[model samples]
Structure formats: C-alpha cells, structure tokens
Target: MSSHPILHANKTSPFGDLTPDEFYQKHQVLHTHSFISTNNKIKLYTQTWRPIAQSQAHPPCGVVAMIHGYASESGWVFETTAVAIAKLGFLVCAIDLPGHGRSEGPRGHIPSVTPVIDNCIQFFDEVRASNRHLPAFLYGESLGGAIAMFICLRQTGKWHGLVMNGAMCGVSRNFKPVWPLEKFLPAAAMLAPNWRVVVSGNLVDRSYKEKWKRELVRRCPRTKRVFEHPPASTALELLRVCEEVGRRCREVDLPLLVLHGEDDVVCDVESAELVYELAASTDKTLKVVPGMGHQLIGEGKEILEEGFEVIFSWLKGKIKK
Candidate 1:
C-alpha cells in the first residue's frame, strides 16, 4: 500500500477566500498520514495524535475514532481534541470522511447514510484487526456525532465507549426544509446542487467565535464558494439515522458522554439532553459548558483541556469498572 499525505489549496468558499497555506501552517503541529482503505475504492486520510509514550512496539491505552462535521475535514475539526485525548494515553485517529479532505469520493456528495456508516464500521474493523491491545471508542463532532450514534446503534457490540460533542439529532429550523425537499425534490436540487442559501446564526464567545469563524473561512473555502448549495443525498440520510438514533438511544448500552455548549448556535442543547436522558447505559453523563460554542475544543485552550480531562477521567473510570 502506498502512503503519502496530500495537501490541497482551498478552492471552495469559506476557506478559499483566505490565505490557505497560512491557515494550514497556523495549525500544522499535528501529524498527518494516509492509508488506502480495504474498500480499495476509497482513499482515507487520517491525522493522528498518538501519546508521546506510544510506540509501534507498545500498544495504546485505547483507540479513538474521531469523526468531523459537515463540509469539514478531520484536520479542521479536532486538532486540539486529538492532542488532548492523545495526552490521556490514547491513540487518536481523526478521519477525513469521504468527499472531504483527501478521502476519495465525489467532492461533496453523500448518496445515503448507510455507506458512511459502513465506512466507519470498516475503519473500526481495520483498527481491531491491526492492534491487539487497543480498545476502540467513537468520538464525533457535529454531524460526525450523528454518524457515530448511528454506528453505535447498528453495531452494538463493537465499541468500548462513545463521546459526542455538539451532536445534531435534528437540524435547526433553517436547515429543516432541506430534509423533506431532499426526499421529494431530489432531481431539481441535484441538478442545481450549487444553489446558494444564506445561513445566519449568533455567536456565543465573542473572541473565540470571531476567530474560529475567520479560521473556518480560511481553511474551508469550498463550503461557501459553491453556488448551488444542495447537500449530498447521503446528508439527508443522516436525518433518518438521527431519527432512528434518537428513538433507539436506549438500545446503546455502552458508556457514553454527551457534551454540548450551553449557547451553541449550530446544534440545540436539547439534543444533548435527549441523548443523555435516553441512553440505556447507566454510566452516561451530560456536561453543559457555559459560554462556549459548537467547537468546544477550539473555543479556548483552557476549556478544551478541561473538557478532555473530564472525558479521560470518565474513560478511565469506565475501564476500571
């Protein structure tokens, strides 16, 4: 298998309008590498933050499968979280979901939810077969969190635990119309998928929110550049998964931690509450970080560190029990 990390200039909206190389350089501390998936058709890119104590000869305390949000790559989503989790003695694998980052697929098309979930399952299988000592956990942000929840529901016995930050059980009202239209008006939108739509929201953390928004604009230019703005059909499938996951949350018997910002503009805090209340696991916890936004880890170094500490402590306690 050939392996080399690939870097592309930002050509899409949000990031495209900024200085792409500078944006990447600012957060270039993490290690990046690529592996060809067993499903040879898809190329997967992963950014890893392994514990300093870790070596090929010594297995990790656990393996964390990190998934990113919509229109964003793994690198863009969890740089700080990955490092923090790694410091807690785990191997963090932040994957670029298909159609984002270096992963191969139609640029921004997701035909349905099953394929994405299948890819995640395949990823876990690969990890389990490759590393004997490492237990696997799911860590997802935003839309990625929704995907993780679906995987946990469908493949119940596979994971050790699950951690979700700003998970979307349902899209906001502004984005809701797209859900139904996706099911009925598929042809019209797909034909003009680049159609533009305005998304407006308020910021919770004035400083971090502004900086993060600027960073997003710099790193993910494609998000805003597309004129025809219909998300992939697979994106709609995400809602179906979310509906099922919300109803079947009780089916997930593994330990779970659902974290959300109290003032999150992207995803409602109620979603986190629902997951916390519905999960069948007796060891679940819901933490609401006051004055933070959707990107908990990137909101601030102190907030990010404290959040990871909570997660690590919880994971440690779970392992002991």
Candidate 2:
C-alpha cells in the first residue's frame, strides 16, 4: 500500500485494534466478492457482514441492506460501518453500483437510475430470501440514499425502516452545475453521454472533513482514484433523480431516520429537512449534526461513533416492534 500516514497510523482505528484481516474475521464479515446481476450480465461486487452472535443455533434481530454513494464501492471504507452494524446482531449486506469500484461499466456513467435500482432490488431480494425470518432495513449514503428511497417507493413493504446518511434528496444549489451549463446538460448528454463534465470543484476534497482521509480514499487503486468528474449522462441522470425524489417526497411513508451533516454542501441539509417535513410517514426523524461534512468517516472518531449510535438506537427500537 502507499505510505500514507493514515494508512500507517497506530492510532485506534475505527476498524478496531486488530489488523484489517483480524478485525473482519472477528466480526464474521465475509470477504467481498463478485456476483452476476443477471439483469444485464454485469458482474457486481457484493459484501456481507453476518452477526457472530446469530447463526442457525441463534437468530438475527434484523438484516440491513446497504447501498454506497456515487463514485464509491461497497468494500474498504464502506465495510467498516457494515461491520459495526453486524456487531450489533444484524446481517449487513452491501453492493457496489454499476460503473463504480470493481463493478463493470464505463466509470461513473449511469445513463439512467432504473438499471441500478433494479440490480439492487434483485440483489437485496436474494438476501432477504435467505433470511426470511428476520426483518430487513435499507441503509444508503448519498446517491445510494436516492436508490434506497426509490426502492422503498417501488417495493412497498419490502423494508421495515430506512436510514439515509448525507442522502441526495435534492442536490444543493451551491454544488449544482451552473445555470447555462445545467440548461445545456441534456443536449450534451444526448450528444456525448460518456464525456467527462468537470464541476466547479472536486467532490472528494469538499466531502471529506479530514485531509488525510480524503487522500487515503483517493489512494484506492480499485476505483478511478481522485479525478472522478461525473460523465455528462451521469450528471444529467443525477439531476433528474434529485428532482424526481423531491417530487415524490410526500410518498415516503415508512419509518425513516435521515442523518445529514449540517455543513454538508454536497447534499443540502435543507433538502433533507424538506423530505422529513413532506414525508407522510407517521414516524420520522432528522438529525443534522453541526460541523460535519458529507463523509461521516472524515469526521473525528467520536462524532462518527455518535452518528452510528443514533442509527443503531433507532434501528433497535424499530426492530423491537
């Protein structure tokens, strides 16, 4: 691995004191591997962390289906949080979206969200089938949050609860493509779907609160690394998804927990609040923690733990019901 200080640091890792392999083994998290989506013959990368406390002899309290954000994979940094949930007696499963990480596609090029959502639903269905005795919840971050929202709407009763962290409910105006460029995005998408569309600033730098964490994330060789400018089609599709999600906010009627950083410029806190207010769900909670950014992992260790504490507590209460 590269000689980054964060990678080499002996500080108490959020991953725990043991080595990476040791921690995963202790947590009973299965090593990440590839699976065929069958929908489009695309090989997708998937990973699961099963609660050590629960087996055939014992039963899990619940299962969590996780979806990572845009330009992200389900392995590495994402797995850390999955392991945390598994430690709490829940089966946690995650999938890398197409065109991201180890999944096959033109990097960061999602012409439409339908295929991605369909792949996730198929994969999640398989997970739920295996653990039919347990309730299933959906967890997502950023674009993955949007996917989860769409899934819940399309497949009502498939999920018991939904947890969204820094979700793209509505793209912040500050981060959106400028007016003329936004107007021209559709034509450009039709003309050159795969062409890179550089935004005003890099998302990695803006999203992560810690500089080292950003660098560490960029060091991953499996992903496209640092220079991830969304493609024309991908950008246009994201805009459409945000708009559609906003329009359908009132349709969200399940138990919902929306966690967002108050300073998350990547996905506006205001948009998250709008969803919370508009959603018809009888039970809904929104926590906009102060002084945080889009990437919760980049927040200091204590705040990260605090965020998950809220998530786990909320999940536990829901599962008890």
Candidate 3:
C-alpha cells in the first residue's frame, strides 16, 4: 500500500516529475499500448499493465478488464491506478472508448449505450484471449460501472467477479436539470441529438473532494476532455441505460464489489445500494464511505486508500491469489 503510485501523483501530472517510462520502471510493471480495430475503419486505443515477471511461471493471479468513466481515457491519472493494480500481480487492460479519447468519433457524443458496450466487449475479449487459465474480473469506475454490469449481463458466466468504483448506477437528482427540462430530454434529443444540455453543476467541481485533484483532471494531456454536460441524445441514452441496469439487477450473479462515495453528488448512492440489495449474487459486497464524492480515486491518498484496499483484497480473495 505504501508503494501505491497514486500516492506519488501531484496536481500537475499523474506521474509528478517522473516520465511515463520512468514511472513504469520504478513501479516494476511492464506497460504497453496498442490499437485494436473495431471495424474496417475504427480502431480503439488499448493499454496493458503487467507485474514485472519473476523466475516463477504463472505469477499472474487473474485478468482485470478496466472501464474508465465518461469523458475519461484509459491513461493519465487513470493509468496510475492501473499501475497500482498491476503491481498487485493481476493483469490489467483498458481501452479508450470511442469519442472520449484517441478513438475517432464526434467529441462527447454518444447517441446510444449499446455500441459502447459492444466496443468494450470486443476489446476485453481480446485481452482475455491468451489468459483463459486465469480468473477474469471486471472493474469499472463511474459510467464504466454500468458498462461492466452490462457486460456481465450480456456475457453471463464469462466473468469471475466484478468491481464498481463510484459507479453511476443512477444519476443524482442534484446533478439533473430542473423539472421540465429533464422531462423534455427525450423529445429534445430527437430534435437535436448533438445539442449539449444544461445540468445543475460542473461535474469536476462535484467529483473530486480535493481542489488540487480536481485541477489535475483538467490537466489530463490525453483525452483533453473535461465533460461538462452530455449532449441531449447521450443524456437520454444514459438514463435509459441506468433504468435497464436497475431492472436487471436481479440477474447479476457474479461475485460483486460496489464502492461508492456516500456524498457523491453525481451518482446516487441509494441506487448503488438498490443494486446490491436486489442483485442475486450472494457474494456481493457494498461499501459506501461517508463524505466521499463521485470519483473515489480522484480524492488522493488518505481518502482513497481504504476503498482501494477493499478492491485489492476483494480481487485477491476471489481468485485466492
């Protein structure tokens, strides 16, 4: 825990003064990135982080397919956490979803959720191809949480366990647009799918508990996307996706861990609890830390350590690694 990379991060960079290459070397992890074709034209950016190999064979305990939140990429500060997990002896891989990072699409535009789910499945499946002998788990943060749930639902029995960090199981009322606008989103979406809607507050202001950490997100060199509010169609699609996930909670049978901030102003804490309550998985666990906000890892060392420990221990226990 003392060696966790995130602890070393500063407001200016995910690696502070260390170059990306130096950071990976210092942590004793092998980091690599590549692009995978979603089709003949679209290529999704992907990353892999693995513990530096020892003399012994089969050191990796499991494979973790990570999903980052909306308007975020698979690298930057997110990569710091990925390094933290890789050093824990698990294989971790993530992809920049289309429209969010380097992947080509209209900026901040997601007309639907189904294609996003499919894109993740395509990338994650490739990551697990050679590691079939190891247990497979899904780890998602924010909107990634919903994507992870949808993946498990769509490909039942394929995943050994799941982890959701500050999951957007449902939107917080505090973040939603006032009354009639929220009611009119679907109609507005049909009329102008590309138009961005007005939400109550800035997401970054509400997401990170620490001021510097919030600034760090804006400094992300990759992606360069600090999403303010979703376009109408994407906003409507997110609501629909949330509703579907809620309705299918009873169908979630994978070993699950739900980590949420009790005071999260973006995603409702009660909605996460509802998922935990209704999920059919007997092995599920939920930890809603009081006073924490939407982005758990973004809160810096002290606040994040416990939640991260829970995630680490939970993954290790499930695979008995």
* Most accurate candidate by lDDT: 3
Residue 274, candidate 2: Cα error in Å is: 0.6
Question: How far off is residue 50 in model 1, in Å?
Answer: 1.8
The digit string of per-residue lDDT tens for model 3 on 98-184 reads 887777777777788788889899888887887788899999998899999999999999999999898878999999877899999
Query: Which stretches in model 1 have alpha-carbon errors above 4 Å?
Result: 1-32, 38-40, 55-58, 174-208, 220-235
Which of the numbered candidates is closest to the native, going by highest TM-score?
A: 3
RMSD, every candidate, angstroms: 6.8, 3.9, 1.5
Model 3, residue 102: displacement in angstroms?
1.5
Clashing pairs in 3: none
In order of appearance, the predictions have TM-scores of 0.76, 0.92, 0.96
Clash numbers, per candidate: 20, 0, 0
Per-residue C-alpha lDDT of model 2 across residues 222-270, encoded as one tens digit per residue: 6645236788888999999989889998999999999999888788889
Q: What is the lDDT for 139 in model 2?
A: 94
> Compared with the true structure, what per-residue lDDT tens digits does model 1 show for residues 215-316?
554454433333124353544455565676678777878888998878676667776788789888986888888877676654555565566566677766
Any idea how many clashes model 1 has? Answer: 20
